[model samples]
Each structure stands twice: as C-alpha cells, then as structure tokens.
Target: MDGQREREGRAPRRWRHGPPRWNRWGDEEPRPRWPWPSTVLVTAFVLFGSNLAAHAQETERAGLDPFARALLFMTGAALLWRQRYPVPVVFGTALTTLVYLGAGYPYGPVFVAVAVACFSAVVAGHRGAAWAATGTLWAGHALVAHWLYRWLPPPGGPAASWGQELVIATWAVAIVALSELARARRERWARERAERADAARRRADEERLRIARELHDVLAHSVSVINVQAGVGLALLDTDPEQARAALSTIKDQSKEALGEVRQVLDTLRTPGDAPRAPAPGLDRLPELVEQAASAGLTVEVEGKPPHLSPGTGLAAFRIVQEALTNVVRHSGSRHARVRLGRDGDTPRLRVDDDGPATGAEAGGGGNGLAGMRERAAALGGTIEAGPRPDGGFRVLAALPLDAKPATHVKEDDR
Candidate 1:
C-alpha cells in the first residue's frame, strides 16, 4: 500500500504533516463547506445596496421592480457555489448581472457577485473561463448601454457616456488582473510546498539507506566471527578445554560489539537529531578488524600505511575492508586474505584479495555486501569493483576521492 502511494506520487500517511487543508488549485485538499456566512452577508449587502443605488439614480434610471430585486438577490446567492463550481458560478453571475442592467435597473453593488465569482474561478485554475465570463459580461453591457438603450426602459434616457464605459472597462480589467495575480501566487506557493515535501522524502530515504548499510556491515562481520568462534569452541570442547574457553570468549566480545553498533544505529531513529553516543569506527580501527578476522579463522595480512581520511571516508573505508574480509571468511576456501592500502595521488585505493578456486558459498547470502559497498562509494563520488581476479582469486577494489565530503544526503542515482 505504501509502495502504491509512492508510485502514485503521494507521501506515506505517516510522513504527512496533517490532514490536507483547503486548496483552490485541486491538490487533494478536502472541499470546503459552502461559504454560508460570507455569502449571506454579501448577498444582503448587494440586495440592500442596490435599493440605495436605485433611490439615488431614481429620476435618471428605471425604478427597481420586483424582478430587478430578484436579479440582484440571485446574482449574490450564486456565490454560495463559487468555490465548488467556479466556472458555472462566474458565468451565472455574469448572466444575471447583464440581464439586470439590460432591464435598466440602476447599477449598484450587483457587480460584487461577478467580481467574487471571477476571483474564485481564476484562483481555482479556471483562468480561461473566468476571463471569458468577465469579457462576455462587459461586452453585453456595452451593447445594451450604447446601441440598444433607445428601446429599453427609462424613456428618453441618454446613451451611457464613453467616460462611463471607460470606467467600467477599467474596473473589469482591474478585477481580472487582480484575479490573475492571485492565481500566479497560488500556483507558486503550491510548487514550493511540493518541492519541500520532495526534499524531505529524499532526506528520509537517504537516512534509511545509511542505517541499512551500517547495520549490514556491523552484523555480517560480527556474526561471521561469532559463528566461526562457536564452531571452534564446539570442535575443541573435549580436545583442548583452554582453547575452547578462548573461543567462547571471542564469541562474547564479537556479540557485544555487534549489539553496541546495532544499538547506535537504532538510537538515530529514536532521537533523530542527537549526536551519536560513541565515535564511529574508522581506518584507525584496522587492528581491531584484523583481530576480529583472525578470530573468524582468516589470516589477514595488512601492507602499507593506512591513509589519512575524514571521519566519513574513514568509516566507509573501514566497513569496506570489514565486509571484504567477512566475505572471504564466509565464502572463500582460502584461509588467508591480503589487504593493501595506498594512495593514487589525492585518492585512496584499497584492495582485498583471497586466493581461491571458488568455494562460492553465496557470499553474505543474496550478495548485498558488494552492492552496499558500491552504494557507499558512489555516494562519496568514489567507485567500487569486485569480481574474480584474473589469476583465479576473488578481489574487491575501492577508489575513494580525498576531496569528497561526507554524504549527508545520498542520491539513489546521480542526477
């Protein structure tokens, strides 16, 4: 289910900030309840305000008949559905306003409904519909006021002046312009919110992969050592009691170290922003890895000096070496492995090889070890190559850049 949501471009419910809020842009936000209070208030204002406007312009224009008052009320009431059905509401309001004007009812707050409807339509991403409705209303009004006024009510009323038409045109243009500006801002804000969610998800996925790699390295190496020591203890229990005691002791230490590392990784999940309780293991702990490998019955020969490395690179290098040796002990028939550490200019080069005719015990079961190593290297702008050597042995080679910083957020793929 979570995978489905991810594939469908939705974050998991657990990661959501809260229930979705209202969005005019159709972003899966819940539909708001009909705007009762605001719509009712506006409708009341338009109805009463039209009466006031009619009283003021009484001598020069037609009086407000029952039909004129009904048109005003209907235009305002149409606002109730503006957000839900913006295009229809806008067109409906525009039509009612045009009819009221054509009947020669004195102009008043009747245009308020048209303005609100247009605003809602544009913000709802129906820009074309909003613009069309506003344009149609204005053109209709111009025709009635100029060319058709001779046959309409208020006998002998003069044709509307060009100045009046200009004012109305300017008002319509201002309404559309303001609505368009609001639409642009709404879209920009939505885009920004989506970007923030994507970044957060990327960071989360990177952290999860990091923890997975850490746990794999720690458990694979330690458990392999423990398994070997347990076997040795069982085999020598009667023949060499003292040797068996030493093997049991190694098992205890390896298990304890594995538990500590696992706990450290878990701690990050629990108290995410807190610093680690212990410093991460690095190349300086090479001797410890050698000792652990020896306990697992693998003779590890280390040549050349360990290169200086940043904490992250050092930890990665240490794990690469650790995983390589674990693979040898678990899969290779050869009891001996060689680790060569050196530098290629500013980059560090690490190679681990075991003489083998192929024991092929499914190295680390399902072969995540090598893939994990490659991911770690790739994250730091480095490379990993692991395969059968030309001379019939298994080899793992790593080249890591010195200037590469710690991967605070690793990409799944370089993009």
Candidate 2:
C-alpha cells in the first residue's frame, strides 16, 4: 500500500506541503481535496453500481450464480487507490474484466472500470502502462465478442468486427488525449505558482534591505551626535560646569529624537499593506538639521535654494547631508563644515566640505555610512562623489533631480 501511494501522489499520508514526496502527482502544493483521485473513485463507484445491478438481473433470468458482481465491487474499490498505484490498479482491473467476461455473465460496461484506471495511469505519467492496458483490453474485448458470438444472433460480416475495432480504438485514443491535456494544464498551473512564489520572495528581500538601510541611517547619525556631546560634557565637567551641563542636555535631546526616528522606521512593519504613510524628510527640515549640528560644535555654513522637490528626492538629499555632517564630526575632527545646496538647471546639487585628513574614517573614505549615502543617491537616479579635496579636506558632492530631469548638461563623477 505504501509503495502504491508512493507511485501515485499520496502526500506521505501526512505532512502535506506541495505534491507527494516523489512529485509523481505534479502536486507540489496539496489541495484540500485530491480532485483527480476523487474522480477515479467516483468513476469506479458508478461502474460498480451499474454492473452490479445488471449482473443481479442476469442471475435472476438465467439462474446462474455468477461471481462477477462481487468481483466488480472489488475492482471498483481497488480503483480508489488508482492514483497511488495507477499502473497496477489498471492491470488488476483489466484482468478482472477478462475473468468477469469469461464467466458467462452479462457484459454491462465492466471494462469502464478498467478504462478509468487506464486514464489515471496515463495522467499520472505512466504512458507505457496505460498503452499496455489498452492493448490488453482490446484483445480481451475481441475474445469476449467471439465467445458470445455462438450464444447470440450474428450481426453481419467482417464490416461489423471492423466497426467494433474502430469504436474501441477511438474511445481509447480519446481517453489518452484527454488525460494528456489535463496533465499539460496541471504542469502549467505548477509553473505559474512557482513563478509567483519566486517573485514574492524577491519583493520581501527588497523590503528587508530598505528597512535595514533606514535603521542604519537613523541610528548612525543620531548616535554619533550623542557620542560627540558626551565627549564634550566629559571634558568640561570640572573646568566649565555650565558648558558640561549644556552638553549633557544636548545628549538627552538627541537620544530622544533618535528614539522617535527609530520607532517610526520600525512602525512601518505594522502599517497596512497598502496604507498611505507619512512623507519622507525634505528640505523644509534643513534649517533644523543645520541648527542641531551647530549646537554640536560644528561651525556649519548652509547656502542653497532648493526647488520644489518630491518626497523621495528630498529624503535622499536630507540623508546625504545628515551623513556627511556626521562624518564631518566623527572623522575629520574639524570645527568647521560647509554645506552648499542649490540648483544648476534641472539638477539639485549638494556639497559638504570640511577641513579633515585625506585618509582615515574622518573623510568618509571607507565605511558603511558612505556606501549607504551612495545607495540613497543611486536610488533617486542621481550620482554622488566623496573624496579628499586638494586643500587637505574631505568633500561630498551629490547632484540629484528635484523631480524631472535637468534641462542643462551636468558633470557627474559617480565613482
């Protein structure tokens, strides 16, 4: 029984995920009900019911206790497992058909049971077994017709036998063709389902990456601010208590702000699948951002006239500036940083420069922060260049469109 189920597609009788263990059923995913298997069982039941009724009537009329009725019941019951052991069930049913016909019982569509099994076998990808069963049944039919010939009136000549063969051949061909068509449809459905799963997985991975980048940007900038303030507070604790107190206060405010921003990013997971959320940071917050950096002891000069910008471009610009300034504080050890934001034709350009070492962490030369800024710019179909300037300073220059393409020519050193 296990072997039979194995050949068919009974999903291990447990742990059904996709198709059966062997994939013989082409059912990687299990349906609530096995439709094809149910079909074979239903066909078997109908054949059994009809043949049993005819066999009973024949027994009453001819006074012969034929065993074909019980055999038909057994054959039909065996067909319930046709999906599990299609080839075997088909052979068994066909052989039983011959026995039932040889027993001098009335012929009442008993071969229909075998036909259903043959259909199951062919559909299950056992073409060899199905054709063998078909040939055997055809020969059995010829034998039965010959056996009954002497017991009944002759219909006609060789034309009658030829007509019988033609009918049998046509029915057999139809069954095979129908099974093949159904198999084709099943394969197509499986392919479509697989493609959809792959697409869904890819989308999930992209979302995870987006969220990861957001977390890194928010936490990295905020934590760096708190770190600088803490260091200053520690340095001024004894000599300048008032200055140290102010630094501690800055730390508290920046920590709270960082917490809020982190919470916002995390909350995105709870948002409805297609709900409208808050817009990203834009140039409107640029003044506040510059003020905060000023409070942190970075003498920053901001000069830019941003055009009307979309949420995406605004967010990209804001993060680039934030990360650049944070890098200014951490890597350059420079007291002064310059920020320039303006429009040159269609492209909105931003440059952050600070007097810092040409090599090392201060210049944003090698770190996740710089790489993330580049990704942010790239996502907006823009380019950014970050490197050491000729005057012993670190500079980050990024130019992205506010919304539409820049009407004027622009030079971009993306690498």
Candidate 3:
C-alpha cells in the first residue's frame, strides 16, 4: 500500500499519526498539521454560552442538566474534524443539535457548532451532504416542535412559531451562499497560480535554447579555424618555419577569441539579470570574420555593404555567416567563398556561397549548425534556404525583415 501510494503521488495514511489534517477550507497541501486551537475555543464558547441561554429561558425550557450538557458538548466537539472529515462532522453536529432540542434544551450557541460544520463541509466540496444534514436538522426540529411537543420535555409548551422557522431557513440559505462565494474565489486563485507557473516554465525553455545556439555558433566557428591552422602548422613545420609560425599565431588568436566569447556566455548564466559584459557580435564585425577565414586558408570576398539592421537582426545575420563559413571549412573542398549583402525594400537579404563538391563524409545537412541558423531566422519571423546550388557550390540565403516579430510557429527542415 505504501509503495502504491508513493507511485500515485500520495502519502500513505499512518494510524500512529491519527487522521490526516487539512487547511480550514480543506485545500490539499504538501504537509498537514492538526488544527486544534480554534476547535477548542469554539467548544468552550458552546459549553459556556448554552448555560446562559438555559438561564434566560429557565421557565420556557428545561434547565441545563447532565444529558443536555452532553448533547451540546457532542455538537461542538464534532467540529474538531470539520476540515478533514467535513461530511461526517456536519451530519454529526446536526444530529446532536436535533437531539438537544428534542430534549427541551433552550436555543443558544449550540447552533454555532452546526453553522461551523456546514460551512466547512460546503467549502470542502461537499455541498449536497452539507445541505442534507442541515435540512434534516431543521425538518426534525419542526416535527418535534409542532407534532411531538406533547411527548417531549417541558410538557404543555406551545409549538414553535412559523416566524421562527422562516428565520432559520433564511440563515441556512445565507450560510450556503457565503460558502459558495468563498469557494469560487479560492478556485480563481488556484487558476492564476497555475497560469503563472506555466509561463515561467516557457520562459526558462526559451532561454535555454538561446544559450545553446550561442555556444554552438561560437565554438563551431572558432574550432574550425583552429583545426585548419593546426594541420597547416604541422605540415609546414620542416618545409617553411616562418609559415608554420604564422599558422601557430593564427591558432593562438582564434583560441583566445573563442575563450573570451565563451566566458561572456558563462557570465550571463551566473548573473542572468545583469547587463552583458560586452555587446553581442553583429554584421559590423564582418571584417573580423573575413580576416579569421583568411588565416584559416579560406578566401572570403565581400560583395556589397550590409544595410542597417536592428541589434537582434544584425546578430542573427552575423551568426548565419559565421556558421556558413564554419561549414565550408569543415565540409567543403572549396578554398574561396563569396558573401553578398543587399536589401529588398525593407527586408535585409544575406547570401553565402562557396564553389564545392561537398566532402562525402558530411554532405548531408543535418547538423546543429544548420539547425541553429534556422532557429535564429525563425525567431525574427525570417526564413533560411540552405542547400547545394544547381551548378556547383553550397548556398545559404536568409531574408530577415526589419520589423522583427517572433513567429508563433516556424516551419523548418527535419534536420
């Protein structure tokens, strides 16, 4: 039973701890502790106040006796389990109240016990049980007052007035109405809490994806350059010492730049709400990419000036170009690549192409680099087209709009 309860996300009921307790409104909580202070105070009120009522109605109803006192105590004590066992408490209180009235005890704070029980039951989602318990008490009172009064205690007492019954009915309606209002408000609060939790989860997921893309773009480009330079340095070490030294120098510079960018990304994770240490890389840094590619033994030609772009669009454009060059170095035999930048009215157009018979090992376009490029474009309501050109090379074309709005849904390749 304990194992089954654990699997079902519930704690097994333990007899040693008595019955499981709950909040006043019976809302489920992770941990439960008994609520006894309020119950004790209420019981005290019922006991002391009933003696006062008996004194006031001494001539009309029987005085407080052992049996009458026991019945009043029973009604009040039942409320100790009102939150945990609302239905049973409500019915128990009503039954004891009925017995007290039948035995000719004067009306007093004994009714307070029934009211508290009914309120607990109604708010605990047991409306029918609460209503039935209350109705049974009221109906039983009418029977004893009007028809059974002759056989009951304090003989020859007149029947209860219709006005008194009307007042009792109105009080019952008011209790149920107030309980219903409280129940509705609690439900609304629970819904708002759930919505806030869901929104937080979504924001966390988006931030995680953004960080993954940034790390991939940075590491892929820098590592590709370093790998190429390492190979060139090893091959030229004996044939040309100066060329090998230049290759080593390029390796050091690329590695240093890569580490700086990675540390910046880590700093964001450590202090997420703080401003970034440096501005994000954008198209304005295109010359740096050109120089890096040249050092990696790949020639890159810039055809046209990139148009002015928003910070977000510029960053995406720069990454798309960086990832494109990285793929060329890692997957192509082409030594030269061309980049064309233009604007079709309000939309910025970027194209990177390289003459290539793609390396047979990784000719397929199913890598993290391609996926990251597509994700960047889609986030800004843009589109990416990356594939082999008809005549020879591989091509990556992006159309990014100036009025950037994230798409609700973005369609991409299976990759």
Candidate 4:
C-alpha cells in the first residue's frame, strides 16, 4: 500500500513535469539502454540471410573457394551484436574485409556491417560516432581494394578503379546522411511535443488556481456569516423570540445559499459531461444579493436603475459585489456599507464603500478584498479602482463594458 501511494503521488508530479526530455546526452533521454533481445534476434536473422545470398552469388560467379566462404560466413554472423558494440563491430568487419579482399572473396559482408553500424549510431543519438565509423570503413576498403588489385585483380581488371571507388564513397555517404536525417527528425518531433505539453500544463494550473480562490472566498465568507447568525439566534431565543426567529430564518437562508453556491462551484469542477446544467448568478440576482448582505448585518443601499448588460459583464458585477460584501462582513468592523450600481454612458459601473475604522491596519486588510474584486472585474475586460478613501473609509469602484463591442455612446447617464 505504501509503495502504491508513492507511485500515485509521483504520477501527477511526473505529468506536471511536462513532456519527456529530448536532450540526447541527458540520463533521462529515451534510449535502448540494454541490448534488446528482440533486436539481437532480428539482427542475427538479417545477417544469416544476407550471408546466404552473398554465398550463392559468389558461388555462381567464381565457384566456392572454401577459405573465402568460411571468412564471409563468420563476418556476417559476428554482426548479431552490432547494436551492443557498434565501434567494435565496425573494426571487426573492416578487418574481415581486408582479409577477404586479399583471399579473393566479395566485399558485400563489410558493407552490411557498415549499414548496421550507421543505424545503431543514429538510434543511440551518436552522430559523430556514425560519421567516424563510415569514414574509417570507406578508407579501409579503398586501401584494401588497392592492394588486392595489385596482387589479384578482378576478372576484367583492377578492383580499385575510379568507378568502383566512386560507388563505394557514394554508398557510404548516403548511409551516413540518412541516419543523421532520421535522428534530426526524431529530435524535432520530440521538441514540438514537449512544448505543447508544457503549454497545456500551464493552462491547467491557472484554471485550478482560479477555482481555489473562488472556493475560498465563497465558503469562508458564507460559512462565517452563518456561524455568526446562528450564535445571535441562540442568544436571543428566550428574551426576544421574534428577533430570534428572524435570525434563525436568516441562518437557514444563508446556509441554503452557501450550499447552492458550493454545489455550482463543484459542478463547474466536474468533468464536462458530468457537470450540472445550472444557470450562473448574474445581475438579475442583484436584489437577492443585497438582501443577503442586509441579513448579514450590512446596510447595503442601491442607487441606480438596473441596466441591460452583457452576460459576462453581469456575472462580473455579481462576483464583484459578492466578494466586496464578503470582505466587508468578515474584515471591516463596520455596520453600514453602501453599494451603488449604475450605467455611465456605455459602461456599467459598481461602487462599494464601507464606513470602517480609519486605522492603517484596518485599511491594509481591504487590499486583499480589493484585489479579489478587481480580478473579478478585469476578467470581463473591465477596469477597477479600489483604495482607502480620503474621508476615512474604504471604496471599491469597477466599470464593465455594457457590450463586448467597442463603446459607441459617450453621453454620461448619472444615477
């Protein structure tokens, strides 16, 4: 169970780490660290098949010379472990080619070994090693062919002719170039994938932070009010039954509203198909919002006629007032507060001010409240101005566009 927990914890951290690293030299880069058994078996089959074909060709061309045939078979068989030790395989095959060329055998097995080494080097992300291996193999073959021609030329003439040398050089360059291209393509694809994954992770983190802040502000303020009202109701249960009943009713209403808000938030957090289909609170609920604040012992006052605002603007206004009132009830040691909502030209404006203590300490707590309110407003392409007022109070002013489209009307409509 402990091991399972460890794995579970690491899974998210690994996901949060973004895509896999593409750095070829890094310890974490993906590579076949060990000699894969399947690769070894496949390489062996290829070697055996190629050697058999070469043997048949050599027999048809010049009859089977026992010594030459045995050397060719052994050289081909040795390539089974080429991927495990590419450099060693290259040297071994080169040596075998020199001996075979001297003994009048074909150079086909050596070319096969060069191809295998190139593939291994590319897959292992060792371009320099592949280049060096190809160069050495070509030089060794040329030198061996020159000597073989001096001793025992081909049926027609010397094997070190310009045509033969050109063919060998071209084949070597092609193999090396192909391997490098494959490696580069793999690296490019890995980089693009990593970038996309990082962007997705960042987006997820930002969304999660937004949800957390909303939950904290909503639950903290709502629950705190319910607790306060419940206490007040209990205290006045016997002496002032009527007021106590009203306090209890307020407690019930606040609790229900808090539950509904939490449920809506949770639904938003749910996976898309599973989320509840509920309409979000908008400016239409502003009156209920005022009543809720009034029940929480705040003197919320409205000043202007409600204006027709865009959905986004309306939601922003509601959240702004919600967060502002929440802060006033929780932090401000004030009994009276004013909330003014109006239209100014093509913009919808909201101003929330509280008659709180004038001390600097009290003023600083409003900073967080103002920030939350500002964020709510700005998310809808709106602007907010919040600070301690000159007249020993706190003020929050937000202006949201009535329409997402550019403003077309400039005439002021004062409330």
What would the per-residue lDDT of candidate 3 be over residues 94-121, giving only the tens digit for each residue?
A: 9999999998989999988998999888
Give the Cα error of residue 411 in candidate 3, in Å: 7.4
Off by over 4 Å in 1: 1-27, 362-364, 405-415
Which candidate has the top score in TM-score? 1
Error of 2 at 284 (Å): 1.8
Which residue runs of candidate 4 sit more than 4 Å off their true CA positions? 1-104, 147-159, 234-238, 273-275, 305-313, 342-348, 358-371, 374-383, 399-415
The predicted structure with the larger TM-score, 1 or 4, is: 1
Candidate 2, TM-score vs. the true structure?
0.73
- Would you list the C-alpha lDDT of every candidate in the order shown? 0.88, 0.72, 0.86, 0.67
Q: Note each model's CA RMSD in angstroms.
A: 5.6, 7.7, 4.5, 7.4
Question: Per-residue lDDT of 166-219 in model 1, one digit per residue for the tens?
Answer: 899899999999999998998898989978888898889989989999999998
Which residue pairs come into collision in candidate 1? none
Residue-level lDDT tens digits of model 2 in 179-246: 77887787687778878878888778767866787887777777777877888999999999999999
For residues 259-296, could you state the per-residue lDDT of candidate 4 as single tens digits? 88888877866785564567766778878877877877
Pairs with backbone N, CA or C atoms under 3 Å apart (clashes), candidate 2: 18-28, 18-29, 19-27, 19-28, 304-341, 331-362, 346-406
Looking at model 4, report the run of 10 residues with the lowest lDDT sum. Answer: 406-415
